[model samples]
Target: MAWGANSRSSSRSSFRNSPFSDFGSYMVVKNRKLQEQFNAEASSSSNSCSNSGKPLFHGVSIFVDGFTVPSSQELRGYMLKFGGRFVNYFSRHRVTHIICSNLPDSKIKNLRSFSGGLPVVKPTWVLDSVAANKLLNWVPYQLDQLASETHNQPTLSAFFALKSCAVSVDAATRLTDQMKSEAEDPLLKGGTIKGDNLS
Candidate 1:
């Protein structure tokens, strides 16, 4: 019985030291610490914003659509922290900017048709502003609509993929040049391109 108990104790010790052992517990502890740290930072930033008496986005009302990077909730938290109002619905006159990573043509048209010419920006605008401790210009953080084969349709990829399709060198060069020009143009920088025919 004593020998058996000793053997069991050794086995348990070996298991504890194994590569896979205690992984869950280790992660739990690490997560707790990270949460604590984040909470502390958030509290401090909130205090700073309040104390400043001039929040970065005091007058700006924002609406989010199709944001995937930091999540809508996370974006709201940042906006609220800096005294910005987050709205559930998009208002042409009331909402100043629409933040989105993805958008449909109907939604884009609705924003564009607005008399105010509502600016549509990417999620990085919020994140970068928070990091800079000020409202950086949204112009640089804007997301451009990549004109694809479909008319007035925006997609993540600028060119539609064609499996085993061969293209002339001149066509490829022209396509590359056009893409480069689009990227550099300030007018086409925002979430939606304004032209009636972009491609």
Candidate 2:
């Protein structure tokens, strides 16, 4: 009856001692182990935070401006998840770091009043640190590290901002091109409806 063979003998077992059986069993065991590991890690992290009686980012306050890789809201959520605080205002006393692709011109005056240099870093500083599950040094991600700061003023570089803008433009251009191509496809062309004569 298999494939219209009309013979029982010809319909031999396709799964006889097959490797697929072993693979399926292996996958089940692997999945179980993975779930256990994840649970253990989550519990450990939670326990550590509770036992220390201090948040991971105890002394750090982060401020987000402009558009970022994970979006400002998502970035803030990540920070909050890691026991960090997000601030709306930018000040040396309040904000420890300014996370943005571009530093707003208005903030420049405020940055000048700081006693020490303000760390203006890219959003990847947050993302990478989260990925590593530890706080990372801000020097590598600082947007204004190269320029000299004599008056404790924060400096920003156009390199990361321009790159982010170019990437966004490329993505938008690609989306527009795809839409245009889909519109020009013959299968997408609407067919005319015709009425049948009943008289």
Candidate 3:
């Protein structure tokens, strides 16, 4: 049977039948460790003479949205590549409050109910920074000028995916030209463009 984007959303059965649909739980727990640490520190510091107050969850968190990647094969491949650490941390019971950004309310509701069925009573990882920076810079994004209609192939997507380290082609080209000029200086002269991003 083929699964559509809305499949696991409506019924608890669909959710239970699929393992990957519940994978977000793992990411949720991973986000909670720091929250627990912050709460603990707050309790101690509030009682002591350390009057300097600090905000926990640091006033903002990495808001993420989830989409059922085209298929489990893609999902598993994503796991092989980026989801290992994200999945492993869900083993902890303290994690709860997963905040998924892209998923619709239907999917969220199904996952919520599933968590309710678990043996442990930890709340669903909803709207919380339970997961740390595990996927901090490793999350996925769309490639520029690509159509989302086609399935993303690892070979092609790896080359075009947008990254946190992205730079403008002009800026990049300029930097390359500067480097080439420095390297090809006259035999009697020398040039070194030190510490400048673009020179």
Instruction: Give the top-scoring candidate (lDDT).
Output: 1
- Between prediction 1 and prediction 2, the one with superior TM-score is 1
Judge candidate 3 against the unseen true structure and give its global Cα lDDT, from 0 to 1: 0.37
Report the lDDT tens digits of candidate 3 across residue range 1-199.
5577456566667667755457677456545764565445445442211122322222222212254323323322222332121222333243222323244457545554654432221112211112332222211332211223225535555665544236566678899998788677653235544454583
TM-score of each: 0.46, 0.42, 0.19
Q: By TM-score, who's the top model here?
A: 1
Model 3 lDDT at residue 23: 62
lDDT tens readout by residue for model 1, 1-199: 6759988999889878876457676665665674465456555666335335688777767778875588888887776677676766555655788888877777666656662656678888888877777777987766576223224655545444332134566688899999999888967767576667577
Residue pairs clashing in model 1 are none
Alpha carbon lDDT of residue 186, candidate 1? 67
Residue 91, candidate 3: Cα error in Å is 5.4
Q: What is the lDDT of candidate 2?
A: 0.64
lDDT of model 3 at residue 163? 46
Residue-wise lDDT of candidate 2 within 128-191, one digit each (tens)?
8766666789888876532334336433556677789999999999999998886777655454
Model 1 worst lDDT run, 10 consecutive residues? 158-167
Clash numbers, per candidate: 0, 0, 16
lDDT leaderboard ranking: 1, 2, 3
Q: Lowest lDDT 10-mer window, candidate 3?
A: 120-129
